[model samples]
Target chain A: MKNNLIKMAIFIKTERRVFFALVFLFLVFLINQGLYTKNKITSQDCMDGKCSALVPEKPQLSRENSFYYIDDLFKNRPSGYYRLTFQEKSNETEKIILKLNTYSEKESFVGELTVNPSGNFQNQEIFFFLPEGFDSLLFAKENSDSDGNIFIKEAGISKLNIESEKELVLLKKTVIGDTKTDLIRESQLSADYIYPWLKESKTILGQIFRSSDEYISAVSFNIDINKNLNPGSRQYVLSLRKVKYDRENASFDGQIIADLAFSAASIEKYRQNDGTFLFPIYGMLEKNAHYLLSLDNSKVSVDKQNYLEFKGSKNNDSYGGGSAIIKKEKNIYIIDGDLYFKIYGAEFHQENGVKILNGAKIEDSGKGMGKYSYAAKGKFIDLLDLEISSPGMGFSEDSKVITAEANDSASFNYTVNTIYPIGKMNFSATQLKAGWKKVSVKYSFNQENWFDMPFSEGIESRIDSIDNMDNSENSDNDSSVDNATDISAETTAQEMIQVFDFDIIPTMKEIKTVYFKITYNPNDESKAHSFALKNLQITADLKMK
Target chain B: MLKKILEILIFAITLAMGFYFQWEIANFVFFILFIFLILHPIPSRFAAGSAIIFLLATAFLTVFKQNDLAETVAIWAYYLMIFTAMLSFGELRKEEEKDII
Candidate 1:
């Protein structure tokens, strides 16, 4: 009995020891797993500094007209000043650096500097130093000029440090520039000159499509000088005097459109049609005091043949001058000069009751007047040059119709080389004439054997709608089929349909070309069935590749 | 005594295998060890020594090589083992005192 008790005691002791050893191993495994999990969590959180980094919220600025700001400086404007005030926090730093970021068309400006504290140590303002010339060149131009526009996205102070006796203390507070009131404003003006004689003006008493008015004429003149004139001796004055007719109703009108003036000169000599006394002027001189020499219209002889005369002389000349008789001849102005100038002129005319300048080479080519039509067509009109093809009849370019005559059935095929993966086919058909029509597209990988192209859900829905419309139209006039003449009138409306969401071609692998086919057969043997199919387009998912 | 030694040997082998093949077996062995320590009466000094050895081995393995799922299991098992060791030691001391009385 004592031996049995000893054996049981030994067994119990061994079991306890085994349990302790196993527990020890378990504890070790658990500790290792815990450490691994902790590391994993830490690593995941470190991505993009999303969980670890602290980002400050930027202040919002109120914008005017979705563009201008109330207190903001105009971008690239001269003297563009912005003051950034820093609110004193618990962790006061001795030196704070303010960073500026600007984006402009010509150049991008990025600047940073250590800020100087204001009078009040608690509140600090940093002024952005912008030069006058820089602002004028950058901000003083139109948006279309392609220069000098700056957009400030964000600005903030970083690396803020305080110097202590022993060490440098880094502040955790982030200083963000107050964008609400920090902006510049700029104002500018632009001007252009437009001549009244060149522009066409509409008249009330004119036909909408055609006008009975004839083309009118106007005259212009130019002078080519042979001798180079000194800067101080090149001044001249040009005058155009009209004949004194009824004064209220004059047949011819004359005006000096443009005069290339000289600086300061006296006329050396005067002759008639000699062309040897004029001098070539190089550059434009500063516009000094000049005179316009006028001739007395009442003293001059006036007649129907004698219309107007152009005269040019030195500004200081009292009597003799260069003269040219102005005459209009078939879209041209012939200037017959009595001295050294002869000008091939431009003509102005009246077309369709509106005055138009024809021969003058105007710099600005304005928009043309739209053609006026008495009868207007449909707004959605598409002109397509399509090549219609069939099996036995071959192909014809610019064909408008694919027809089946009498009791015959016909199919027209159009081959399109699709470099992209086409998902749907769309087309419009006109004058279907109560006929059975089937439209299908087949794709080829090797250009030898063709398989039907698949369609998407959108195309399937469009096809269903087209089928429904045909059924509804057929049911409305069941007796129209017996009368073949009525079929043409009934099917005059064009039908547009998109074929989609088909499982015909499972995979479009290297699909080089697709043939779109339209087959038609009329129910009646007496009637001819014809339909014009146009504007065939295929949509593709280019992103799939 | 041989059975107890064989049991411990098998446990050590399974724990090593768990690190390579399947770690679930090691976890199962740990549960059995915890149950035995809870139910059986042992000396407090012995249990304390075993706990210390287990903690040192766990630390070494964890620092050297470990996986995600096993690490998670190890962490929970660590806390459970610590609690069971403390409870078993306390029970052992009580039993020792009763035996002395």
Candidate 2:
């Protein structure tokens, strides 16, 4: 019995030691886990700061209108008598006068008309004035400022006389400076433009399928011109001159009616020859000063390069510049120069801002390659032949990238590579702990041809280092001392810097060439704008290897 | 005592292998853990630890690369939890012998 008791005692002692060891191990494991979780949170913070989209809200009252008027006289007025034959006896001679004024002018004007419905819908008359003489047109064109004014090309006009009134009408009004006419036309022209495909269409059960064709029934224009002008010392005037139609044709296969017109064409060109509608326009410009003009749905052709684009409605009250989208295509083209204008012309200067320039507010395009498809803005001249190039204040280079820094302890673990064109990029430095941190990006056209492309400015780097400067005994004393030392040091050291290695080489392609986007964030808040380009490059030599 | 230590070392090697090759043993570990939790009168925390190790191993494999084995192991683990819940409900009315089994 004594021997058995001794053995049991020995066993119990050993078990106690093992249990204590296990508990110690458990505590250590828990500490490690807690540390890991904290580090994970820090890493998430870094990711959020770098790539998350935090776009600023648009201003409440942005200068939204692009229409500027300087020339007092009309360039092209409607001369020929317009005869309209309506199904009902509708006869009326409407004398419509185009007025001009800046937003600051504070005066409004209107035109009067009489409607008389007569014989058939075929012979109806809607007579108006226009700039008719080519010399007068050129002189008038030379007279106005060259800001953001788009001259309407003859191809943008379409007029249709429908035999049936049951045809549905679709209205689309793009910003005056927008140049995506083909996309709009494609979306508007196809029979599927308004209706879904038969396979994709859902039946209401009561409605039956029919083989009847649909066409445009009526066309109208809603033109709004707003300009801020000063009278005496500053010649502030606003004028809306009628534009002329270049061609009129009908379609047999029901493809679409294609019509083109000059910038001087009546507001009626806002409608298609097929009687489709484009309406509710907003035009604005400053009086006696340089202004930009934007043509709606202008057409331009890119030399086989895809570019970033914006497509959305402009708010009536403010100008947040609509949302932007990127489009890729082999050939880039604009519908016309309808949205192109400049404020340098004689009419724009001497006319005292009388002629209300057509279109919307235009962005300044600095010295850059301007193609029909892509538009660049800045203080320099546009290298590409754009309809309008307005020179304005240039933006800072650092303004291109968004950046942020987090205060206190932080860690970064998972490093995600923003996928870009040449190849996939990986970060060697994935984990960043406390203390001042640094990162650099290398850019290249080919995966093997990496070049050091450094960040010029606006990149913030920070480190959460231990602050042992506070020598205090009390808890409050310690907190205050450390807070003052650390916060002050952080504020002083908060400088954003970005640097990359690069001797960027452009690649040439044999067959199909494309510009590839490597990596990006859809919603990054640090950026002042909506988008950011880490290391973007464009060249004809860029091709798929 | 020396022989017992050697045997334990060998057992540890098997555990490591089971953890590394989670696809093969993940379902088994999940099943054993369920049995130990719901059916066994005594709660075996050791069994829970083993199951967690197996789960971590599987997660590590899937997180690194795309693999069918890791996907299969994860799916099995989810189904096992559901099955265990159902079996515990059925055990409520079972005879003592059936419950013990």
Candidate 3:
């Protein structure tokens, strides 16, 4: 057949070269699937994590214009208790007298304040105590009569933030802790040196001062109720008792200790038509304290407009430290005058200043978020403000701290809503094991009233003969230094930082929210100890009424 | 030539046992080797030129899809109906010849 047409033209030219090499390999696999579905940028686009930040620098208490100089501060500083909060803005009603010299310019030992300005921006505060360590830190407007030109501005000299919060209806807030203590005004007399006296509460109304220190949350009393109330609400009750005496100081164990029900209508609005308003009771006082004003008014009807009048001290001993009584039915009259009260005292302030807690606000107390964590059995660790309990604690903003292993039942807790009036707390641990009562601290504003804080061996710890688990049970006189430093938490020099301090204010006064609970109990001559506590500081003592 | 190399060595051992076994037993051993190579044959103008380039790229990708491709144009219309049944029973029912399985 003509050789089959030459074998069909060489099999159609070798099947057209295998269909042109499989259509050039399917057009190079359709241009590699269209460049892998249109590119993306993968392998984790390179990775990250590297940081560094710090900004905080704006607390200026400046004044280099002839009037408020702080001799540039540093002249061997640390003498204790300092305060200066400036913000004046006058151009008229002036009468400034803010001196604090020394180093011989001695303008009367660190303390002075007498402003009388009007025309807006007026916030002039002063509280001082240097005890020898100051030559200049000025605000001298020592009154050259009236050459008004005071414009101080947001000044700040914070050394233990002071403002023993005075507010018999002055409600200020903010600026808390560390004037190093003092603020006892027991009777420095001021409401124009005390005068009014009207008396009426048919019975219970004693007033016995005398606690110049040790504790006293709030107590100012200028008396009121002249609206002759047959009104709607009334329950003024106020008790403080615990007056025990014998060593010739008299007082006699009055017992009671805590109760303050207030409401002269939150205290006559404030200076309600003058004479001298004043009103504050807030408890936690301490005679070890005794104060009473209980007036149930027993559903009024004896009519003198439902009675409410108290303010005495126009004469008689004008308060040498105790007087003014009424207690009926068991009789005890004695009232010649002496009830101008204002003991505000409540020390335990802790403010040589160093607070350094490190948690960065850990969170997860059911989504307070802040940091988040989860694990069972009371593993809540949520510290927006704070809470504390431990078992194998764990919180780590890259190791700020919450660690555990050393025990004495060591307790620490934190929380704050900040309405505050008094507070004092401290902590610094490496392996804290200061014995005697081991260590027990308790505090609370609403954690169901815990209160137990008072361990201050006066502050001076640091006698670690090897701890953090007492070096594997006391270095046993050499078994190779007890298994080579046995496992007594090897090093960090016994984790030294020690500080424990906890006096805890009178008890409770103007607290909106504050929670503290510290614990440490393991001490039966130690064995297998462990410790490393970075910080716990919660210094409180801010007042504004 | 040895039954065309034993039918391409049993379709290359059933496509390598359909990639190592159980591909539904390689689709029942390639449906019994397609009933023993359904009369066999193999070249019909290169399978009608690869089924007319997969029926014009799967009918221009199921109807002018314009580059929108992540494969499924009904799997290239089932590989253009197996190359249009190898150009209809492997060469238009042998009207001319060559091309079958």
By DockQ, who's the top model here? 2
Off by over 4 Å in 2: A1-453, A456-545, B1-54, B67-69, B95-101
Candidate models: Cα lDDT each: 0.29, 0.24, 0.41
Worst 10 residues of 2 chain B by lDDT: B35-44
Rank list by DockQ: 2, 1, 3
Across A441-536, the per-residue lDDT of candidate 2 in tens digits comes to 344333455444343444334432122222111111201111111122234334443333233333442322122222222232232211122222
Regarding TM-score, does 1 or 2 come out ahead? 2
Name the top lDDT candidate: 3
* C-alpha positional error of residue A278 in candidate 1 after TM-score superposition, expressed in Å: 51
Off by over 4 Å in 3: A1-68, A74-239, A242-254, A258-415, A418-439, A442-498, A501-514, A518-545, B1-101
Q: What is candidate 1's CA lDDT for residue A361?
A: 10
Candidate 2: TM-score? 0.20
Give the winner by DockQ: 1 or 3.
1
lDDT of 3 by residue, A197-264 (tens): 22333356656666645444445555544332223233344555556432223343643433433333
